[model samples]
Target: ARPDVILPESSLLNLDGVQDAKLHPSLGGFQSLYDEGELAIVQNVGYPEQNFSHFRSTDIWMTGADTNELLATGWLGRYLNNQYPNYPAAYPNEDVPDPLAIELGYNLSVAFQGPVSGMGMVVGDPEWFYRLVNNIDAPVPDTQAGDKLRYVRLVTKQSQVYGEVIKNAASKITQQGGYPDTELGEQLKIVARLIAGGLQTRLYMVSLHGFDTHDSQVLNSDHTKGEHANLLATLGDAVRAFRSDLKGLQIEDRVVGATVSEFGRRIISNASLGTDHGAAAPMFIFGKHVEGGILGKNPVIPETPDVEDNLGWEYDFRSVYASLLSGWFCTDSSTLQETINKPHEILPIINPSVCGTTSSYENLYAAESWVRNYPNPVTDVTTIEFKGTGKPIRIDVINAQGQIVETIIRAKVGAGTHQITWDASRLTSGMYYLNYHNGAIHQSNALMKH
Candidate 1:
């Protein structure tokens, strides 16, 4: 939804013949990290049959279920369950004295709920957990329920071992300063401290809310000085500080952070100066070991846009998960299939050098299509000519940075030669790719606009 951060060269003048486009200026930290090769942008990340409902979409993302499927267990929960089958019954042993996953908040996300019991623990802090366990002073009834209550209290008290472990680890090192005072910053600071303190936790989850910007997304007087901008600034600053803290702790390469949203905003703004729920948005992944560069093509802003028009996705969100499982965690194909329930193409998000040996994989990104844009160096306009199979066809203008600057066409055409006029007068002078795709056939033709 933040085009300035993803597609910095996209022009509103070209789409609507009105306002000019520019970077939001609130994303300086992200820009700096990207320029320094610590961040990679994944474009048009979504799943098929995108349901716009926030609750449903969030469930789909958390549980890693298909749009029409219902899943009770989360993706990571399934993985952890598979990895540690003796969990809950035989945890906190000599080899596993710490929580497998930790969520730095009060309520644990559904993502950590295992098929049987929760695969992780959630706490605001070490003291918080201790106080919760100690504050249970209610009297129990003299019946079968009393026996159940006693057992539950005993189990709760036994879990306090985790609290002691967390306290010991956190006391090992004071956090390296530079984290923003924001909530996300504090949460990430705790994560860094825990990891640095020798906690064997493999997964940590933290969250930042208020992204449901239905109104007042931007200021009328200044488009970049409102709710969305403030959130972005918070995110950018907190993440930058977290990265610095990780580097200072010498754990930069051991951790990777990524952002996920339920859905993206529409391409068009409403009367309240905010965008509505839409499909397909960009995702950001950052770490020292990440292959820092843009992945997949940029989203295509359509010509003659309408309120109903939303960005189409290129890479599925499952693909990103698959990459992490394969590239970062080095999980086997059986694990991948069990986690995501399907095979998805693995992107080069993680550095291959770090992952010395990996299972054989496939690329599901695109196929070859026969298409060409005439007039190599067009100063004003160019003609995109291609043959389609009477199916749905899409043509996008992709810049060198892999951002889709403009969409030339997206429609069904007859099986014959078709030519569409693309006005590139408003586009910057640079090398671009005219990408055409119709189902299994996809291709990109180089176009130079002077």
Candidate 2:
């Protein structure tokens, strides 16, 4: 089934911006991804008590913090560090062959910040990345702005860590053909090639801009032939080309792409046929393993909206972040919660083939993975063992729905064998996920509470 794209009502004919626009069907590229069951539309997703300021909203999204609180580290960066502790330090090792995450394009994002330091590598293209890596000067400027960017500039130069590997990968893979000549297409093409060459990077960050359509959103006569239309078409074209390239490269299953913005435009158009900053917009999630569906029904268009009127949030954007961490990356509930610093529901977005227990992703874990729980269905108590990296170890009992049922331990534990006895007699009899966090690494197993 194709996506349902509600076209903007004809700009000239629109008496009030609140009138429901005629359906134009969903974008072609997205429609294809949807029909193939490789896309999920999370509608009306954003933070609560919205702020219209682009910088503030962007900061909120990047840090995954509450609109009121300020957090410096990025959620994705924390997750990657969880998988490979002491990143950029333990990195470039034979066990870990590539940078854990790569940020494409020039958009300096806060989404990849890790504690102590940001853990991802920044690159433009294969050639440009090499040039920057080779010619890096380490002395950071002495200023507030310099201190803020000091970490990013430092990590950007760490290309030496994965430079050879990336170069080798780019040399081996050849893109199939027909990518739009747009900036987004160029970035995605590089990403696809690197993944095909086996970079083993856990996360790839890229973005598309030009969505801040205030004026000339749509043509006066044709609802779909203006600035906004052109942006959508460019995005659709880029996505289609990238999808085809991934298919040709045979690495489509290993990667997933998502779109994010600080805030969406208002529900109503102004006299200039443009929308003001609004709240609760739609986000697109695409991957070979995604379960495609319209997250919910079309957003109920409130009749008679105002400048302040906007779509009510259905799912918090952090919920989608949680989904990517746990469902796609198989991050345990405890680490995932810790990374976001907020409890958010992990959606059933990915197909069971990749998200279920006994999935192939389990093979990616370290050999010294935590021991399994004993007394399969614990009537009174269950015992488990784990090896810590001399860091804080957090053991949590997570219910089937991915909620933390109990906190068995939360203090720092030493290396070697540490046994834990979980008292689950009081809990209801059902399956649960036992999440263990040893330093930056996380491991989980299924436990039955009987």
Candidate 3:
């Protein structure tokens, strides 16, 4: 069977002030934010050995586990548990007066699943939980049944205490105006209020559904008016409003936000006029301190797209996670390795002027071996230098499609600092990756040539 060469009509077009990109019409707010130097996009973000199933892929992303590995705890959960070892024993104290994480929903997300239990609170309504706490009656009789009852009481009592803390924090500030009256907007509005109220929560999670557009993604008459468009509109408007509120409270510089999804849609459309599950997609990061620009080269579209084909990943998704941990939180290399459970390259997503460079990056690859290239965004030629033990070294230059375009070095190099002059004049101006491996030390880095 042959596939059709039909292309889906979209309102996506290049907008003013946005560099090297096209955006849907509903994403005007995001476009404006980018123009103001407060937003950046990382294209082709995905992991190796991607799973296509919704549940399994989502689980892999939530747990931050390799595709073949199964983890009981989540990425953030492990980090939080490590940071606050004695959590829930005597939490909400003066030293740590608020929850470690908060999800604006009724059920705790698996991303907060710790080894013992969920680490974050799921707050739907504080008053409801407060009333439930007050409704607890007299103590039960001294028996096995009483023991279970007491445990339940303790859990509810903890919830009540957290409810009080949330109430106090939320009462400290009112949200600024201009938030859309949509679900995402309301959820983000609450988050803004909590942050403004002086809640010291380090992480917050909120979701906007309806991205699983397998059928009728767009209207037959108008490609711009449909499920996907509505979702983008809600997202862009809410995020812009959230940013304005944060600026109003003068906490814009203190917070950063990024979007994630399990997978992207296939390049080819189906008979239902919708897209099926696909591969790598773009992820956006926005904040006052974000280095505003596109991170990687755009995904390459084939001459004739196939139904079973998918986009290749340029940047491993974990690299972005590692970058945020190191650049934003100033996490140590040891802790960063423990958190992600692997070594991935760190992209320059944060503005070094605001957050400063991480001293932990050199140590992230290995204690004995570390590599870096000079004159980034190079012009014709650049220097590639690295330190390593006496071992066979292999360095491959990879393109945006995850293809190894050149193998610059593949020979045994003695221990100590080494340098290689790479003439990139023959290579086109775009984002490329340097994959270096020597003995047990292996790492990846991004390179840009102007």
Candidate 4:
């Protein structure tokens, strides 16, 4: 039997608060993008019965397969497979000169793993790729694994060809403003330059890591702030700055950006004050051509769950991909249906008219919350343990008749688990409510006075 690894049975606090803000304060940069209609927010997104492991879940996402199935060809790879038939031999011709896809900050992902061979390249940096490809001159292979070596050689050969072209394009443009000096910002900065310099690359993938916040997610007694805050800030700043840079270069209309994660943390916080992997999180889509708005409602967080399935299941992730393919890239529904092995409904996330008869995509990044007050049946005084946003939060104590008894808390709170002592020595013994209200989040905890 799995014991309660997080909260005790007497869990209390009041974090279900009204949320009016699109993002947390730490993510202010992203908020600006949303205001400009450059962000489309899709909340509560996940596959049905989502897998929790990082590797398996990422594989499922990349290859567009269910947890029980495995696909050698990636969803994107299948798309490219159709784009360039007889790919390896027919590619590098006049019609297909540049690489079809480019990935930054990692090796080739399964997203580009084609049926025969992967149909993409991974360049950590344009300049570095230039030097590496230019310097390499491997002699003809004399090994028995001739076919495999030849494939390897072909990848290298293409890398060399792309290296010079990418390098030249990168040199022609520079990022304009507001980019954080962080890894995500740097990688996105490279993407902006390459795009501005006239690289007709259809698919480019960049990454930001460290979303696996299993323990110490927030500071002790201050659940509002911690490692997750910094990560969210980095994301906000990177995307905002990248968009600004693109607009400055007058190419903002040509690109769209989507932010996705493999899974969301469970509603219940673990004993270490962090969350376990769960299903149905949010996805962010940003671009000038986006039909900016919230695609669906936020995932409903339950008070207590007997099973992981208690977490709400919402828009499957494949729907987002289908919309992007059919509406954004103008790919037909039949092709996407065949490639993904599912007839995922189009989400209407992209602006159809932006790219001249293309098909149609909100940014909401608020922190998750928890609360617990011990000694519920107290005689005189009681203590409330509240998990809140990193910014200032307002806690109100109300009597049974829906009148404010007292304003218990109103201040900027740090990250992690927090506690507040509430003295109800003056009020008559009766039922009451403890309410927590941040800018957009609103929640209440019922209190029994003895």
Candidate 5:
């Protein structure tokens, strides 16, 4: 699920004991670098039951009725398309560009793609982006046909210049201070720079790869270090550094970061001393807006051996997404339903009983609401209940920002007290919310599990 702040490949680090391990590569010396006040060790956000087979093909993940319908345009894409309907397309070539003479970039990713004239900017080297903007007037070099070799040289030079421009844009990105040298760190640095530069970007997207750790994952004499551990260390350092950088700039309140992957590694270590393909993985969110604690009920890591070689899921991944759409973005529940395309309200819009009350209603706290899992997180069964006037009601689970996760109820009932249990043995772990509504009243509450 998408949130203001996300760490797609976050690690569960021991922030307190890392100071003395500064020289250790495997540990990454996190405690030595960050203050306890700044670090939070969150567990159970990953998909314990991840299925690797499903990740090999985008179609498998994107075409499934349950998965595809939940994520039609991606969280960022939908937000941008809806926020700025007039923003230029990601791609609008001259020959292929519409008669309207619109200029566009290449493929559109909902995170960086927006309809607002200047609501977002692709994070690149500062000098390069500026060069592209200024070089719009630069003329293409011309050479006589008899001197074909000269023309080839010119083209090569131009290409090099273009490459340089891109690099410079990425390098020249300037913020007040604090940026890690890692790839994802650099990208985030650029994001902070853009925000400081008044780019007005409301949604940002960045990624870190190398999480497919399938071999040699232990720190033994025979095995140097696990691929998974190293990757996790980098992730921890980069994210911590990014958070520091954002705080230094005083823009932490205005921005959030979240991370996702196609899927997660298998729970059971493989014969090769590494994990294999699995279903459901963890996702992380970071920011002042985040509820800085673990969410979701932890899935049971089965001790009983099985051929599947993976842990089970406690909550559906879609529930996390649904929370983002409805909660953080402040989008209408109905509109979100159309985008997600699942039946039943995935998120609760208004507290059904509180809707008519005069008592001051507080905005849901991002951290507090998400910090605790209710009925405990479940792997096989989850109970959904509603209390109020006897009426037909529907219940839905949404993620932090209000994207629907799953519809728990849809039928009418002579409602005095009603409860439904979800067979979520096949879902992932993350924060989710339950929305309950009758034709006349609406309500929402947070749900969490590992």
Candidate 6:
């Protein structure tokens, strides 16, 4: 059987800008592109307590317990390593060793580095890879036959075998139908082809970089529409295309795709009108098995400037990871907790049983409604607005999965436009929902805490 998972880098799960009418027009056609897919806007997957500014200052990316204790071994890596120990030994020559181990300085990805012969392939530019693999030459032995000649033959044989494997893989991919031209897009296409070809690969890894949108992030004429938008568009197209291609091959149901990033940017716009390093960003999960629609409580950005110039964290990120591990992968919650070195309640697993079923948005009371946030996908303090007859009003921040992170207000007030400020000076950049309750009625609106 093929690997059931596909993980990519730097992906945004639920962006409000992509959903709004005014903002949608700005994103080209990417808006509403994946509205029907199984979408989970995971809030705060990174450590919220740590100061990211200091960490980024030193260029120390991915240093949390979840990242470091795993020793550069990602959750997927650990899974692979556990499943196949001899996997590293399958790379043609015993002397060559697994490239993952070599690249990470002998520390293997937790998912792929296992005890058994874990068969895998690192998909890249086929032409470049072929050129590098086939053009290798080693000095011939001084004598016709000896220890030297035997070693040379062994090396040549291994190279030839691996070369043939690469060529076959590339040829098969070329002959297959439907793939995008972008890097990650093509990589995914290759992944699909491999799966269709019955490669028996259990874990597939690909990446999409260039998400650090520091300057010129707006879509105006003078300033360039940041790279983030283009990257996301490509990602959306690639994923959708991959899904379609999978359907054509009749294996779409067996595959699941996930995306993550190192961290999200601050809530407030920087001097350059761009975002800087901040805590807790969003994560996305897409597949036939995923429980569709928004989940979790949305976090609210205080509409006041904080001393640190950042937004507050509403949801802990580990909850999302726990959901994926326990729900999608069928791993025990306790085991996942131990692996990530953090203990949080496991979110309700998103399985086929719950797919397509609509869950109530946490604050769905009927009667008076209040809206304290506007222009979601907010770049600064969001103004919380309220409406309805005089009643006690309470505002709460919830993540995508319907988990409440913080309560902004919890008191009765006269019906009118009372403003609550969300200064996002301490939060991670991600999508969130705002819920307002006035005892008798409830209203909820989607907001982006980026």
Highest TM-score: give the candidate number. 3
Q: Give a tens-digit lDDT track for model 1, residues 104-205.
A: 788777877788888998876434543543554456898999989978977876766687787778778764868777888888888888889999899998
The list of candidate 4 runs beyond 4 A from truth reads 1-22, 125-159, 306-310, 355-450
lDDT, residue 245, model 3: 87
Model 3, which residues run further than 4 Å from truth? 1-10, 13-19, 125-158, 362-450
lDDT of 4 by residue, 1-450 (tens): 123223222322211232432455466776777667777888767664467889988998898898689899899999988878776776676776778899985589899998888888888654454454356434555776866786786787675666766767766765456678887887888788788988878899989888788777776754446767778888988998899899899999888989878877776667765677876678899999887867665543333333332244346678788778876778865676677676555666888674465332111222333454668766788889887568788777655333566888899898667897878888776555566655434445556667
What TM-score quantifies how close candidate 1 is to the native fold?
0.74
Encode model 6's per-residue lDDT on 305-421: one tens digit a residue.
Answer: 332434334344555555555565566544664444454445443663533332221123332345757656678777777664576666777653334667888887775677767
> Residue 248's C-alpha lDDT in candidate 2?
87
Instruction: Write the residue-wise lDDT of candidate 5 on 79-135 in tens digits.
Output: 455644554554233332221111123323333323343333332333334455445
Best to worst by lDDT, what's the order? 3, 1, 4, 2, 6, 5
lDDT of 3 by residue, 397-433 (tens): 7664456679989888887898989899998766666
What are the lDDT figures for the candidates, one per model?
A: 0.76, 0.69, 0.76, 0.70, 0.46, 0.52
Backbone clash numbers for all candidates listed = 2, 3, 0, 33, 81, 65
What ranges in model 6 sit over 4 Å off? 1-34, 51-73, 85-121, 124-126, 129-177, 219-224, 333-338, 352-450
Quote model 5's TM-score.
Answer: 0.57
Each model's RMSD to truth, in Å? 9.0, 14.4, 8.2, 14.6, 10.4, 11.7
lDDT of 1: 0.76
Which residue pairs show collisions in model 3?
A: none
Q: For model 2, how many clashes?
A: 3
